[model samples]
Target chain A: MSMGRRLPVYLLLDTSGSMSGEPIEAVRQGIKALLSDLMSEPTARETVYLSVITFSSSAQQIVPLTELMSFQEPSLDANGSTAFGDALKVLEQCMDREVVKATSTTQKGDWKPLVFIMTDGQPTDSWESVADHIKQKKLGNVIACAAGPGADENMLKKVTELVVKLNSLQPEALKAFFKWVSDSIKTTSQSVAQVAADTPIGLPKPDPNNMIIVL
Target chain B: MNTEKATLKDGRTIEFVHDQPRSGTMKEVYFTPDRKSVVCFYKDPCAGSDANRLQRLQMILGAYNPTLPQSHGGAAQNDIEADYYRKLFCWPTGIVVQPRFGLVTPAYPSNFFFPTGPVWLKGEEKNGMWFIGPKNRKWFEKNQPSELGSLIQHFSLCLQIARAVARLHNAGLAHSDLSHNNVLIDPSKGMSIIIDIDSLVVEGLFPPDVLGTKGYIAPEVLSTIQLDLKDPKRKNPNARTDQHALAAFFYWYLLGRHPLDGRRIPPGNTAEEQDLLAFGSQAIFCEHPSDSSNRPEEKQYVPCSALGPLLYDLFIRAFVKSLHSPSDRPTALEWVRGFVKTWDLLIPCSNSSCLHKWFVFHNSTDIRCPFCGTRFKGTIPFLKLRAESRPGQWAMDGQLAVYNQLPIFKWHIYSRVFPSPETDRTRQAYCVFHEGKWFLVNEKLTSLTSPGGNRVPPGQAVELKDGAQIRFSQEHNGRIAEVQMIRS
Candidate 1:
């Protein structure tokens, strides 16, 4: 496959009854910062677009593929059950749309879209159907991360390319994780803008001085 | 967009307020945003909103400029440190911004506890803002050991202290006021980062007058003339100034006290042989000096000797040069190589192969180990890509790109780059490229099979409908020759 030049990222967040207080608020604020970071890079802003997906009893797309300056913050409320399965289906569908957009157009060498999934509780619905497609990387690169209290690491494994445990179920962990996500997106966008498809550019490693990365 | 809550395949929820600008700095800064750039200045500790502003300032300033030390802008290309403050402030909000420029203070206020000292960090989105100074005495009083033996025994923590100072020097600025209090510690990480940069001396306009704490200061500043920090023309703020502080800090980092002829630092200073002796030994309050030999002692100070000689060498250099003049001192660039070589000694890691085992030079393409060919981690590409695009198709002919994302390796398909079909029952999947349509044949996967419900078991064989039109276009030199999408 010809390498893609741009990266479209979607951050899927879980804001349910359990994630009400600080945890949910932290996610909202974190996404704002992440988008802002993406916007600041002149090259990245021009090439990459960001989206947000929040799931509770049902999954919702809070933001579409909007550029940073035009992108608005997503207000989140914590209520109802965690319908993780539904959220996955929505994410896969959204990714399909974005990928299809890339392919249909003459756009060449754009990166496979990235989906970041963050959560903090057990699923109230079965995710078997959606999970199977993701494990096969059906849409693109799906990275599902778990944060805060009650996140089912074992279950999250099904949805993620990698799983991480927060040292605490507090705001800092999610904040740090999002920061990492923001930085990673920034780095990737910058690399694609400057290098060939076959060069070597690695992402920032876990700063031992800061957050820990869970395998 | 009306903010909404969401969940993943694996259940979890988060609450939040999206897109609002949280520009109020994190409780310790004051800045004035302008059209050209964001200019911020740091002052002494503030009480309320001012404090938050400074806190935000602390989170935002960074050191990734390759041209700081007059090194070609080549270095900055490799080390792209994020404007962390932007991330910190943006966290919870996800409004990341870039900082284009910066400046730091180089001296401590006369009255350390007085209302406020000042610093300024210049950036693109914002300008210089005020910052607060440190409370070294209060911090030391609460943390350090009273007994000489205990302080000396736990001296290893000082390596972090030295590295903290080195970081400032690496940024191409001199820490004019190198007092213990000017350094702040993140209690959680157990390492310190320099603060109170109100008097930081930029290397570009340097070598300024000698700055920093009296106890930590090299004898040249004391023996020569006290720097007029306001007078921006002194040469004392050279790398030598930071180097002196580094050597002295190393001694303190190990022995837990300043090497002196009493509580009062010997007036004789670097010119004195005794001060040189103390430095040579890497001892401050204790009689025992760093022994070059001995496994337990050597290993404990970080068994790896890759950097021991450098740190040990600096102590001697400071002892001799910090005497009557600043001219004889080593430069920050020189010391960057020194500490960088000996980085492991300062912060010893439990894992011998850990990246933290030593400070790794960055901004390179292939990272062959300095000793062995084992690749180092986090190296970014340096070659600039030719900016060429033919409408929607960017022609990236001569430039290099990095596939940082690991290739997708599945049961039937080993990898996208190099695929050899085979299948384990659990991971069986058939990829059909008939009529030019790519699809994955799925079966139901078990809860034990997926990560956070990210995957499902293959069930009944079914043709998938992914809801998309594929248009693969072959091109030569930015010209799209053909396009195809035949979904059967």
Candidate 2:
């Protein structure tokens, strides 16, 4: 009754310097597009809370648990090594801190939350523990998207049940991919918008080839 | 707090959470940053004959006012949270208060499946605001609440702000800024509530500026937001805007998404899709015409014969006057009658405007043509859109088929093909189903929809199953192409 109502939208971004150019700019464009798109729905406005984590030198909670109305695009300044493990750990922690919490009110309930994680490189640092943690929740099933010029599709596949590789390193390609990602989210959320919640939902399936599944 | 695990039966350790509104004990359940839900112990009032508790609970939550936002825009979620906080501490009697927003505390008899009502203020944008949902119900497996009973137990901890809105409306108010994210459904509860209530206003008058988010904004308010928002006196919001928003609300309720397909990105090249939505029979304010070519001078705006008539009068209101005189539109109560009838008809649409408003395939049906933005035109007797894209172009070829955008089977006909001048392109068409039934229609004619039109197709029956069995062929000479239904 007294708890806050919000929609958890997680963005797992890659901040590798290779992405310092247009890739980062495009991602920013895609994110702004996502927020702008969601602004149309009353439900998405009050319920969709967003969090962004960039993994460059290390995973940083660039934008903490915020809502569409409040969310600002995180600057993807490229530097340092790609610490995939650190990114995932930080992302999972952000999700935990922002999405789930212990309280004296909930008798018990699970909000089937959706997450979209993207990356462009292999884990330069050890990501086994974080990978293991994410894999368990069927984290792979949470509408995860992976892209990059030198990204490890194998590693990304492990992170997401549905993995895709960008055909080109063009940041436009990344933006296009995110746009499609936005479309798929738009479609799934639209369909789910109808029936009451708790309806068993199949994970989102984006068009392959353009951004085919590597997993 | 082990927030990541769910309850399972085998060694697989399948973590699970049972969302019940009853009070009990469990362990570490995680909630979102907004603090709307928690994993605690609760009871099940639904286990018995206490059906009245659900209604009572709504009344209990409904008792609070302050739902109104202190300003325009969706960023005022804190207005709602602050209200929740204030009510929990100040409300009386059976309305015993709690500390730190006592609504979801384990001390009350709850009929909720999950703790989804309250939303915390996180951040804001030029658009609107947002709240968060419970991470998982697994935390409640150990400890739960008491005062809130168990009715909607298996649902998620998401808020359906409609109930709150409905309460406000019932109390004579309209939530000015209704957008995609303002609502969150506790699917488990089978109910909805409204948030950001301070901005609510009573029915009868149209607000100067459309307060809801952009895409969800109604046509009547379009001119204002697109123009007048710059002028303070131009802001005109009323209960009617709320009525106009009802359709979009319904779309979001059923889809867990937004309604408009929006424009697809070009050749999958960029992130931005077509951002404009075409409305108005003609041009914006400056070029609005008195004798708008799209306006059917033959049609008279007869007062709604029956409010229950689907899009009858409003079709004229939104489309007809949409160009030259948007201010002449019908009232929210009037639209309500039409929509109520729509709900009763059982036809559902993912379209933000006509979500449940079953459109009829009758000549007299009035509609808001997306392309030309006209209303109250004589609809065609037989016409439907088909999906066809060739080397250089795309055309929504007319066929006697009810094209749907199902999740697994998505299609967007090249042209919407409504009568126009409002462009009017004509051609004979046929829809051939795999079952071998073929119905002939015009390219821009035919109302396959009508009163009960959703229940039964007016043309010849063509039962087509999903798969390769469905194929469409247009006429060789550019006439309505011949339709062929072959069973593989």
Say which docking band candidate 1 falls in. incorrect
Tens-digit lDDT track for model 2 on A83-165? 88898888777766665422313311113346677776667899877787787764323555556566667766566566667
Model 2 chain A is weakest, by summed lDDT over 10 consecutive residues, at: A101-110
Q: Which lDDT value does model 1 have at B213?
A: 41
Model 2 regions lying over 4 Å from their true place = A1-4, A101-110, A138-141, A188-190, A193-200, A203-209, B1-488
For model 1, the stretches where C-alpha displacement exceeds 4 angstroms are A1-5, A100-102, A192-202, A207-211, B1-122, B125-488
Per-residue lDDT of candidate 1, residues B1-488 (tens digit):
43323221123322222333222111112121211112222121222234333333332233322222213222233222223111111111111121211222222212112222211111212100000111222222344312111211223234444444444556565667664444533222233445444344665543333244434555544332323545544335456666666655554444223433222121221112223232222223222244222112112232122224555555555554343345665554445445433321232222453322322322245543332235544322211212226455533222111112211122112111111112232433333434433343343322112212233345522222332211111212211111122111
Local lDDT at B60 for model 1: 26
Q: What TM-score does the predicted chain A of each candidate obtain versus native chain A? A: 0.85, 0.81
Per-model DockQ against the true two-chain complex: 0.01, 0.02
> Lowest lDDT 10-mer window, candidate 1 chain B?
B126-135
Q: Name the DockQ score for candidate 2.
A: 0.02
Scoring only the second chain, what is candidate 2's TM-score? 0.31
Please give the TM-score that candidate 1 achieves against the real structure: 0.33
